[model samples]
Target: MLMELIFNLGLLLIIVILLILLSWVWPPDSPWAPRWRTKKETARAAFKLARLGKKDTVYELGSGEAIALMVAASEFKAKGVGIEIEPFRFFLSKITVWRKGLNKEIKFVRGNFYKEDLSGATVLYLYLVPQTLNRLIPKFRKELKKGTRIVSYKYEISLPLEKEDKKNELRLYII
Candidate 1:
């Protein structure tokens, strides 16, 4: 019984250590939005909103699993780049994109997207929270070229809306 108790205590200690590490890397309630997986339907709506095409370049900030990037690359033939902060999500997305034979079409970078340059993007896709969107207002205004499309799911930006999909709860803006 003493040995079993010791084993359990060790296991608990390991779990606690892991939690601490994760919290340090990805703080809960961060200004950056939490991971929210984009559904296929919502991704499709975003694609349509952006009017994506083969020549278009789509950048997804905080792309959790790169689902939206996959859709854009596969269906629209657009070049897709995803910026993911968490290591697990970044690795997972890279593997998934490669497995889908979209290595040439899609790229995944593990880094803070706020620090990356977004000037090359023709369309920017986001599923981030409203707080994050609010914070990105200046970034969008500065980096995005004239008439660049911005598609967001479940949150609206203060910028003038070019289009809105009420059914899927998404908004599109032009810069």
Candidate 2:
């Protein structure tokens, strides 16, 4: 009985340590973390609100799993670029896009969203924390061309609001 108890304790300790390490590298609550997935329904709503359509270049900042980009490419007939900083998420998104045979329509970029050029983007889709949104204010001003459509899920941008989907909790702005 004592041996079994000790083995159980050791197993529990190992699991706890592993969890700590995982959380340290992938903190779910961190503003910069890219684990949160914007649902497909939400993506569709946001894309529709943004008026995304054929030939439109959409950039999804912190695009987890690249689901939004896939939706844009498949449903809205738009081209997309998904930027992800997290290594594992980036790899997963890259492979997923390739496996889904969307390499022609969607591109997965592994880098900082701020560093990625926005000049070519006609639309922006963001599902990020408020802190990240706040930090991007200047980047948006500097990089995004006038008339670029921005759709932010669950957070408001400082730009003038052009449209909103209250049910989906999304906001849209033009730069």
Candidate 3:
């Protein structure tokens, strides 16, 4: 019994170490990866853009771990959809939404955001690099309905005619 216990403990320790190493080495390639932990002000700004009426449907592109989506779903009482490419983050988001009892209000999609339809969304949130935004500009213009609100963190795209709101560490645009 003692030998078995020692072996189990040793295996657990090794697994923990490996997980830590992997987390550091293979950090998620999120545009807001460094800011995985949401700040109060950022969350407030995102919520503001959501304008979250009960009828509003909000979509978050590249929603790493779905933290922002969870908050939006709970605070605004709006339906939230999140698309995440990373499998690990996707699973984590699924668990979080389930544990928060937000499964009904929050949905997590494990796939690329560019392929998803945005016509149904009234509000959109993104924290992606400038290049990614440029690539998605055409898609947004084509799919998003007029007057749909878009809130981007730390980056902005060149749109022909769009409104911009510049707050500390954030930017908002309406299309």
Candidate 4:
């Protein structure tokens, strides 16, 4: 009994150590980076962009947990596509969308958002880092149609023709 207990404890300790290492190495690739919780003000701002019109299709980059996407689908009746890089978070987001019965209006894709096409989107929502946003702006300018709206939390693009509106922790850009 003593030998068995020691073996079980050692296995449990190994598992715990592995999990901790994975958590550090694979920390969710969310644009929010250090922060995972979505502030109410930021969510509201993203919702406002989605609520622009019923005909709008919104693409949320690095959509961790799909909170904003679910909200957009539920409240504005907008179609939402979310891209997430982390496997665990993407699975959690998928489960949430399924449980919420938003499968029809909201879809979550597990991959890098930078590689995905955003041309079909009428509105784009981002909570990514400045470097990511900088890399995406050129693509947005090239592919996004005129009048396309982008809502970003805590970052802005220095486009020559983009309009900026600051409210709370969010920024709105219209191309």
lDDT of 2 by residue, 1-175 (tens): 9999999999999998886666656643253344457889999999999989997999988877889999999999999998888788888888888898988999877888878887889999988767878889899999998999999999887778998899999999999
Q: Candidate 4's C-alpha lDDT?
A: 0.75
Task: Compose the digit string of candidate 1's lDDT tens values, residues 1-175.
Answer: 9999999999999998887666555632242223447888789888987789999999999888889999999999999999888887788889988888999999877898889999999999988778888899899889989989999888888899899999999899999
Which digits, one per residue and each the tens of the lDDT, describe model 4 over residues 1-175?
9999999999999998776666554433443242454665567666674355578888988888878777677777889999888787788889989998999998888898878888888888877767778889889988898888888776765655244345555667777
Tens digits of per-residue lDDT, candidate 3, 88-118, equal 7788889988998999998888888988888
In the predicted model 2, the residue pairs found to clash are: none
Q: Which predicted model would earn the best TM-score?
A: 1
lDDT of 1 at 159: 90
Steric clashes per prediction: 0, 0, 0, 0
- Looking at candidate 4, the ten consecutive residues that score lowest on lDDT are 26-35
- Assess the local accuracy of residue 19 in candidate 1 as a C-alpha lDDT between 0 and 100: 70
How does each model score on lDDT? 0.86, 0.86, 0.76, 0.75
Model 4's TM-score against the true structure:
0.78
Which sections of candidate 4 miss by over 4 Å?
1-35, 49-51, 160-167
